[model samples]
Target: MAEETRTASRARAVALIADVVRWAGIIAAVILVIHVILVAGEANPANGIARTIHNLADALSLGFKDLFNKPADDPKLRTLINYGLAALFWLVVSSVAARLIRRLA
Candidate 1:
């Protein structure tokens, strides 16, 4: 029936949206983790890997980059707070998106 086909199509769309959101969250979390590690480890900025991760994290955390500016003397603390905020931001946004998609579906 047309009704059943429409329902199936909606379900597929919802699943696709959910999957995209889930993957985005996961990738964001991974980037955050890498950023945290590089910062905590005092990775050399001149190194390619460290630079790449730092750049990726910076891009991903565009809005939250300055959410918490720790003292200059305490780089470790600053990294922790900033990266944690970024991770939280991604998780919350993705969760809300998935919920909205489900509701709409």
Candidate 2:
């Protein structure tokens, strides 16, 4: 009876973790979509952060001129690439985490 109780408790914990992970993934996706919309506006406060990131990229490109060729590589281009990569990373990570949690549950 004690062993059965332990197994049930473990199962309940897994379910709880899975639910949390699922919610987190949903929230992150929603946030990313909102951010994209705000960025598209180009006049929102969110744009300030985006601008700063762009400027930093520009500075890095300048410092590492040899790293990125002209025309093919620019601050805006780098920012887009970086952001795309980051979004992909988060999406995959969150999704995998959620899947694993769900399986455990």
**Each model's Cα RMSD:** 1.4, 6.9
Decoy 2 TM-score against native = 0.51
35 in model 2: Cα distance from truth in Å? 1.2
TM-score of 1: 0.89
Model 1: lDDT to the true structure: 0.86
Query: Each candidate's TM vs. the true structure?
Result: 0.89, 0.51
Candidate 2 residue lDDT tens string, 6-93: 9899988887887787666555544444444444455345566655644443333333323334346454454344444444555666
- Local error of candidate 1 at residue 58 (angstroms): 0.5
lDDT of each: 0.86, 0.54
Q: Which predicted model would earn the best lDDT?
A: 1
